[model samples]
Target: MQLHSSGVQYKLHLCLSVTLELILKILELKLMVVIMIKDWNVMDLVCTCVTTLLLVLICLLLYFISVYPENCGSYHGPHSINCLITIWEEVGCKIKGLRYPGVLTNADANTLKIMNLRNVKANMESVKSAADGGNADQQLNCYGIAIPNTCDSHNGPHSVECLTSIWESKGCLSEGTKAPVKLNTAEKEALALLNLE
Candidate 1:
């Protein structure tokens, strides 16, 4: 069996517990409704009313907690909540379209989950293959133009630092004869390719 982190286990346990509590509360409400309809006694009515009010308060609190979770603060809260609600609405629509939809179905969820796992596996394999190839030299080509290096470095000839050295070689430097000189074609092309233009 796959091992889960403590945090994940805790969250799953809490969710199941909450769902069970909500289900029991719903059953209790239904029973209370039936009792109230059968007997119109003052005491029974008051007790039923109090129970229903409490149940409503609990459900409302649960709704808020579900919509605005702790991690909601890390994201755009209202936008995230709207996105979640939209997804839930789509699921609700699917449920309504089912032939004999008495139970919630995870057919779509399971399919999408399997697809996501396959995609992740594919990506991991590709990353592993690239790592196996060893660190090859990355020759930077800027817009069909090659930037020549005047000084040697690990980043090869196309690096901006190496390009600066090339510029200095061409008398483009401070306290020199051509201090504030314009860039040559190669330097300009390199900058353009590097998106520093």
Candidate 2:
């Protein structure tokens, strides 16, 4: 996915700076209220404290209302300020819409396509017939040659399981070429980029 421009980061920083300034001002105001109440009786002190706290709450509410849209996007669902803050910290800005489950990256989407093709090929009538008969070796070789080529044709990297399937289907196991349960660093990284790890 294309990343948003640096304006997002700039706005985030601006919001944070504004929030910090507000907090400092609120602290100063609280200190002033406490200091200005020198001769206040117990009830007066209680009322002053309550009024100061309500003012602070109102200021914070207004501050959140001002920044919520820029930071939280158009999500209408119930959400906490803490959730918005967490999204800002983790993802730079609002996600823009409802984040459905099982969100996939581009590579992951391609891998899933390849996987669907592989599944169809593996479950074909010819392969089923070969399995039923004594032509398993022939079928295996055909798939071993076809599957990897199909994956490459789609420009998708193979996972460890795909590599192992290819190796075994090519009769490498019978020829004493042990199948690998893991791939090398570069191959693993390629698969990881597709989220097939």
Candidate 3:
């Protein structure tokens, strides 16, 4: 979850940085043109400068809005769900030759979801099995938790509480736990799109 949030922020920063660089380049070009054309009328020069600045401002505003979309009612799904759709497209995750055309239909979403679920589930089950293994300290490392001096304060191996906390922290729905796994927006959407959610 933390990784996903960081990834989104990094993308936004990269986009904004690129945008600013482009604006700066355009401004530099305009400055050069103004310097070369010394015969330009004052009013005309002012108008040109104003127009250039306005266009840059507008472009920046539009880009900002797109990066941080407002909460539109989630008929298709939540804003985060829509975000996943974008990330996948950027990395060339394609689902060509649609069965029923017109974007991701129910059938497509279901198929994608099922395929994703199979992969995620298999990985999760492996993790769970490992978590339930002999060494408690090792399981701590498995979930990215710091190894404590004692497992469950010396409650020892097969400690259900320790096991639950480790798996639950990583958002895995282990066999016995009733609580649903807490997923990030993109993960949730990806799972939903694949029909794994």
Candidate 4:
């Protein structure tokens, strides 16, 4: 009632502020889950990490919009804003891994092609089988994939959990190697040209 009495613009500002706080809290919770969950299996880790990433991206977008509402067109209603957030979340998921639920997100039909490692794809089936067979050695190897000590090793799936079932079957990660934190010079230049520079 008090908020309504403050008039439309004031009410909208209040609402947006409240919404930002809520979104931040939610993102914090997701981050907490990402770190707190111990004894995670491949499936659990993949889903949780992807979900956390999407939430983090959403939070960033919300913060930006709250700070720069003028950047959005006047015609955008609450529904449009919701749709935009949903789309961004999906994009974040795709970047992090397969696009959730199911389907080959990267669109490369061959798992080997998606991974981009020679001989790994052909050997994927065998590796997956080994991973699935409770090969502790393979599971331990997956740890290397998780942090990836070197950039040279970072060329495959977005996450170890993103690999196909066959690939994940081996050593928790199968063939999923971490992607690099920093992009190559060409990729950086491309983004810069787009003004994401």
Candidate 5:
């Protein structure tokens, strides 16, 4: 009876040992998986950082390229001033034909008042002509303080006032404010000879 009891005790000990070993193995597996996930996260972060840096670099490069004087192409000349004038004149022409929402529109009234303040009637006329001629390039030059297409519509009195205020602030018809009517350069020689300080 003593021998039999001892043998049973030995078997119970063996079973406990086996269970402990199994638990250890499972724990090791879980640790390995956790380590692998951490590694993957690190790699993902590194890739994202690289991509962001590359995008920033690309944007900076594009900005520099756009502003470089050498990239101005055939428009490089002292007559650039004259060219600008011509472009604005063309755009003024186009704006003339645009249909306003109402003859007694607040936008029209505001535009008239602003124009009177700036004495911008001539410039506006030129811009209208350019727009009417379907000269897209000229129209682009007429931007910055000029009446946008939205102004032709009667949005409201607030919009009209806002637009007029912006135009006025740009020195449109103010005395002693000379409107730019000429291109800075007329030809390659003029550009090369220009003393841009």
Candidate 6:
């Protein structure tokens, strides 16, 4: 009876050891699953942050493009004003024998200094209109020119001449250049037809 009791106790110890090992393995598996889930959550958060940053950058780029002077079709900022002045200077140099009415003629220089002072005034007026929350029409009126209906109206040197003529007709003359009343009969008739007198 003593031997039989000893064998029974040995079997019980073996069974308890097996059950403990299985419990330890199950706990280790649960821990691994928790760690994987945490890693996945971190990766998801990083992806979301990157995506959000990219979206914000794209939106800012679009806003800048929309408000850019070239894109908006007029001088809306300091850069635009500078660009217009540069263009005016270039155009002034190119046109020969065409005197800017009211501007002082410097015959000493090879390039005629036909500075469009009106453009500076027009730029200031545009800035004021923008500050006043005026619409596009008001902005154009402030600039003393009509907005072109088509994009093509803003094309080439001819457009500049046309724009200058309009400003001249409105009595915005240069300071020292004499105004010549050399309009031909055809021109007078045309002006009459347009009621521009």
Error of 5 at 135 (Å): 20
lDDT of 1 by residue, 37-96 (tens): 755464466566667766765665454343322222212222232232233333222122
TM-scores of the candidates in the order shown: 0.22, 0.26, 0.24, 0.19, 0.22, 0.20
Relative to the true structure, how large is the alpha-carbon lDDT of every model? 0.40, 0.42, 0.42, 0.36, 0.39, 0.38
Candidate 2 stretches with Cα past 4 Å from truth are 1-13, 37-166, 177-197
Name the TM-score of candidate 4: 0.19
Candidate 5, residues 83-167, lDDT tens digits: the string is: 3333333333322233211222565434443332123335555554564354544444333223345333212222433343434
Residue-by-residue lDDT tens digits, candidate 6, 25-120: 555654575587756665555556556555655554443333222211333333233344344333322111122212324441113222233454
Error (Å) of candidate 4 at residue 69 is: 23
lDDT of 4 by residue, 89-159 (tens): 33222222222212323342243232322232224334334433455343233222232221112223233
Say which prediction, candidate 5 or candidate 6, comes out ahead on TM-score. 5
Regions of candidate 4 where Cα sits further than 4 Å from its true position: 1-6, 38-197
Who is ahead in lDDT, 4 or 6?
A: 6
Model 2 lDDT per residue over 67-182, tens place: 33233332332433333334322432112212211233555334333433223223333443442244534334222223333233212355556655556766777344344454
Q: Considering only N, C-alpha and C atoms within 3 Å, which residue pairs clash in candidate 3? A: 112-194, 113-194, 113-195, 113-196, 114-194
- Comparing 1 with 3 on lDDT, the higher-scoring candidate is 3
Task: Give candidate 6 misplaced runs (Cα > 4 Å).
Answer: 1-35, 38-40, 52-82, 85-197
Give the winner by TM-score: 2
